[model samples]
Target: MARDDDTLVQLLTPDGERVDRAVGPDGVEYSVDLTDAEYRGFYRDLVTVRRLDAEATALQRQGELGIWASLLGQEAAQVGSGRALRPQDMVFPTYREHGVLYCRGIDPIMPLSLFRGVDQGAWDPIETRCGMYTIVIGAQTLHATGYAMGIAMDGKVGGDDGEAAIAYFGDGATSQGDVNEAFIWSAVYTAPVVFFCQNNQYAISEPIERQTRVPLYQRAAGFGFPGVRVDGNDVLASYAVTRHALDHARSGQGPTLIEAYTYRMGAHTTSDDPSRYRPPAEAEAWRSRDPIARLAAFLGRQQIADETFFAEVDEQARTEAVRLRERVLTMPDPAPDSIFDNVYPHGSPLVDGERERFNAYRKSFEGSAH
Candidate 1:
């Protein structure tokens, strides 16, 4: 898992040292200036998100959930970019963006309901400015691109008040057609969208090396846009780079690709076993450069927060996790007939016919174990 640091924008080292500004090999200088309180807030977010992810993983293991996608090591990448977003911005996320969803003011129970098979995520995308979790690979990029195109057509680009869109995907998504199509459309239409790719080094059991020979960010240049690589483990770097990219897009500069160099640190989902395909040594190497640990070190060294503060945050996170677990356990399942809901805006004859057939089929099995 050794990476070439020459092209990576890192504002905080693994040991907690801060770099005010650093120019990557791509000549992009990344920096961030935040108040002490804001720095502490970021730490709280990282810790809390990690705790929630762990709780969800445990829930899945205990048969409470169908599956859980743990965002163990990518806390900094998600929180940093998520916190960097303006209230006016829109976000389209892959299924694993629980941290970003949390940052978007979504309750943890919303996603839990989805995995629990209760109902689709119980949140309004318009109100939250975040889309529902997209389970299909790379499809959200197209949705985001289309949304950004609408923003552009509506004259919502260029100026401090302008809006933008951000699409989150994994490194494996870069090889998908929908993602590339998004890149092409966004670049051509000058849509105000940023493509945030968290290159977590593996696509399930497939290593990143098998996905592509060139760096992911570099692919943006081929589509006529700027690209940058950032230390995904460094919250400061992630925040700065994402903020800059968002601003560039809002200013009518079109698209940018951000490759967040990081690791999964857990299974792709609760169903997959990372240990089967990932080496223990590789996992150990990434563990040392953990996103949360590095941020905590910086906060402690700078005296922005102390052990007592960390303890309180951990306690708060635990309390929240407990509450979420209770909520998931108590959630009511949707009505059986609800499956046919939302198939069409008004009503579809085809869907109505299917619903009738399904109801008849269910009626036939009534009071029968067979």
Candidate 2:
């Protein structure tokens, strides 16, 4: 059977057209419906996510954060899939997924603490249904798979009650052994988890071609589950596809793989320079397909919004930027003893020993005359 790379439905094209693909062997016709309000909601999601990205980048440059990852180009991909998740669903994310964190009701400030070198993670995962943004590349996938297995064992799967797990990873992480092992575990146990991979063309300085020759969605077939690719820049398509896949998993249909085709318009992090690895022309080309601009254009063409409404959104975005800046700048540094506090729940013998030795050293310094 021939799979449709173009079969996955995309309501808003990069050129801003309302079109659909014919059904093919892959069942590519859109399986979900959305309202005009929902479309506008997607537009809002993209805007705020971008605003947050801009704020984080500025914070990094101002030295408020040790480093920051800018998700300027992949806003649609993250927001689309993120909005699909229910409040009960748990999400494990990579450090770059500030968009996902925003969708999960976590304050944007939560991530700032990690980069500010103040604390490990500021938000409580159980409270927000979001995990700490894992910085170790693909390692969090295994944790997600384990959580899915626990969910299944608790009879959370095969129900309409809204419990599922999701793991967010990047193109660069696709090569990690942990990600592959997660596939094996999730498939064998039929875990109710969704693996959302944002293939933004480059994995740091390396291109996607360096990772895999085959389209990533095709990899799921070998793992014994369904896989689909959607225009990551098309927030509507991304939301619809992810909602369908999560619905499938929640109803005991097993895991689904989603490859969101998008690009990273900014540097990998504040410390890296894109000019060294990417050409100016490539950046300029992706800029033309700016996900936020495309959605704004579509909303205007459909009369879903007017010039005044768009101006409001732009104003609101700037306001958000200012608010984030104030909060980030005013954020207090964590106390010195906070470092050893969260390392253990009760206390570790080694930790206790270290604290004793450190206290003695400090006392010795106090006794010495300068």
Candidate 2 lDDT (Cα, 0 to 1): 0.84
> Candidate 1, which ten residues in sequence have the lowest lDDT sum?
1-10
The alpha-carbon deviation from the true structure for residue 184 of candidate 1, after best TM-score superposition, in angstroms, is 1.3
Model 1 spans with C-alpha error above 4 angstroms: none
lDDT of 2 by residue, 118-222 (tens): 888889999999998888999989999999889888988765695789999988898999999999999999998999999888889998888888888889889
Error of 1 at 323 (Å): 0.1
lDDT of 2 at 29: 61
As for model 1, its CA RMSD to the true structure in angstroms is 1.3
Tell me the TM-score of model 2.
Answer: 0.94
Models 1 onward score TM values of 0.97, 0.94
| CA lDDT of each prediction against the hidden true structure | 0.93, 0.84
